[model samples]
Target: MGHTLSSLYPVHRRAPVYRPKAFVVDDLATLHADIRSGGLATLVSVTGSGLVATHLPLLLRESDGPFGTLLGHISLANTQWKETDSGIEALAIFTGPETYVTPNWYAAKQETGRVVPTWNYAAIHAWGRPVFFQDADRLRDLVTQLTDKFEAGFPAPWRVADAPENYIESQLKAIVGFEMRITRIEGKRKFNQNRSAEDRQGVIRGLRELGAQGDTRKTEVADLMENIESEPPAGY
Candidate 1:
């Protein structure tokens, strides 16, 4: 293999290992959109013992603030919410499509053997103070909204009202509702934006092949990369 004229200079610099903004997504709509699509989130907070985390599905209220509010309910038996302090901060992490890319997927690898394997992923972090409440009426409303949102895609969507009123009320009594008024948020969408067009195309092709082998991760990432590539160049 021989070097080309384009190889005389560095075409792309490696991104920082920590919080590189090459694909940092700051659009408020996009951030909330990802959260909606990926309903499950890991909520983390500092407890008296140390740090504790609970995984739950969160509903986003966009009009609540500049960031937004995360709503969810947990079992009353689970004292994690009770241990949460109003003065302390908490974090909620939501993740979307992610896949591993091999160095062989980059054209630059064949040219200079300089490329290395890396992971591409999309994620969002929401930080706030946890507010817990047990009002029966509010809990019913929150549970109904959560059920409606999740069931909307089903052909025969189920509703909270579908169950017996007494049963639904009893269920709500066993749980506690909480909301996190987001004070800060960070969204990252690292999908080879730092790579050259040639390398990116190579990644897209390789991902497609893996997708054909029945890998959902590969399919999702490939679709996202193709969408970015198909978009008009910035500042048209």
Candidate 2:
């Protein structure tokens, strides 16, 4: 069968989430790693008006609560924070590496002719009530921490202090910080773990071979597939 243009592309990014029992990632350490490396996340809240979503980066505090806490800020002009319902739980989604997978990689495709294409990805979801604040001191502290964490990746890392104090103070007034103490957290890594070892190996090899040609994202997916042996949580 010939692949159509649509089939050549990946499964939709907005595909409804349906995690199989085998896909549930129930480990704190692994969940936290995905949260950290996922970098930017989408914060969604339901309010009197409707649903609002903000895309931003958040700081994870593993020691803050049973699950954890998320720290981040938004522009003063962005009304999503103000419109969020405090009584309702907010959702923050962190997305890691993802790529389109083809059935051609499956050993079953050739042997049994019974395989379908799927997308492999890693993601983390955190839920909690968001508490927004505008205290200058607290905002300063939050921004400082966020700056340090992200800037550490650069050779010449910049710090909050590098900016003029007055400028920083003025800027702080133009934004508000929020804390969402995670009441629940879940991570999912769908990497064909349900497939037979032969099929899984073929997938890894196919992904890596694609990576060798230039698409490093495929390699990232392959790397996770290679480590599907990590112990799953209880009852799963």
Candidate 3:
């Protein structure tokens, strides 16, 4: 056996997220909030063939673990569930609003022409070992939970019982449910947090102007940036 530098000084693994000090979100509660607000998640898994990913909405159960449990279902026709390697951890990426930030929005641009365009956004990445199931009863419960969540704002919410029993049971037989046991979680909110107040104000103005012109995406970014002003981030 050969002993190399690794033997003398072991190296720890770096976090999967490319988060800067100013962008990392550390609060568990905040992370959960962001995940729920994001609505849909991109679930990724390492399989024997390679990597596979699926886009779906997941229900976040905070009482499950320190981080939380993610409930979602996939069609049996989709091979991802069968291919997933239990030994490997999975990732659920929840992305919030994102948009381009023109250098014109930076106050420094006018002074030194030193600013360049960039992107501003928020996202949460959760790591966990996914547990897949095919029980019809559990699948029915999962469907009902997801249904009630999305329909809550309506005057009258539709539910699983609204469908015919035979049809509902047949539908359940076509899908498999899964729950992710969250082992580690991370979140990032990058909305001009590293910029100066003047620069940030300029961004807010530009974004709001765009929003007034019918680009609601810009408005979302602007709203988050404005929030930073009201509640200053505890920067690293």
TM-score, every prediction: 0.88, 0.88, 0.92
Model 2 scores what on Cα lDDT?
0.84
Q: What C-alpha lDDT do the candidate models reach, one value each?
A: 0.84, 0.84, 0.86
Better of 2 and 3 by TM-score: 3
CA lDDT for candidate 3:
0.86
Tell me the deviation in Å of residue 98 in model 3: 0.7
Candidate 1 Cα errors over 4 Å, as ranges = 1-17, 230-236
Which lDDT value does model 3 have at 132? 92
Candidate 3: worst-modelled 10 consecutive residues by lDDT:
5-14
Error of 2 at 177 (Å): 0.3
Off by over 4 Å in 3: 1-15
Candidate 3 residues 56-113, lDDT tens each? 9999999998888999999999999998877667889999989998999899998998
Query: In candidate 1, residue 156 scores what lDDT?
Result: 100
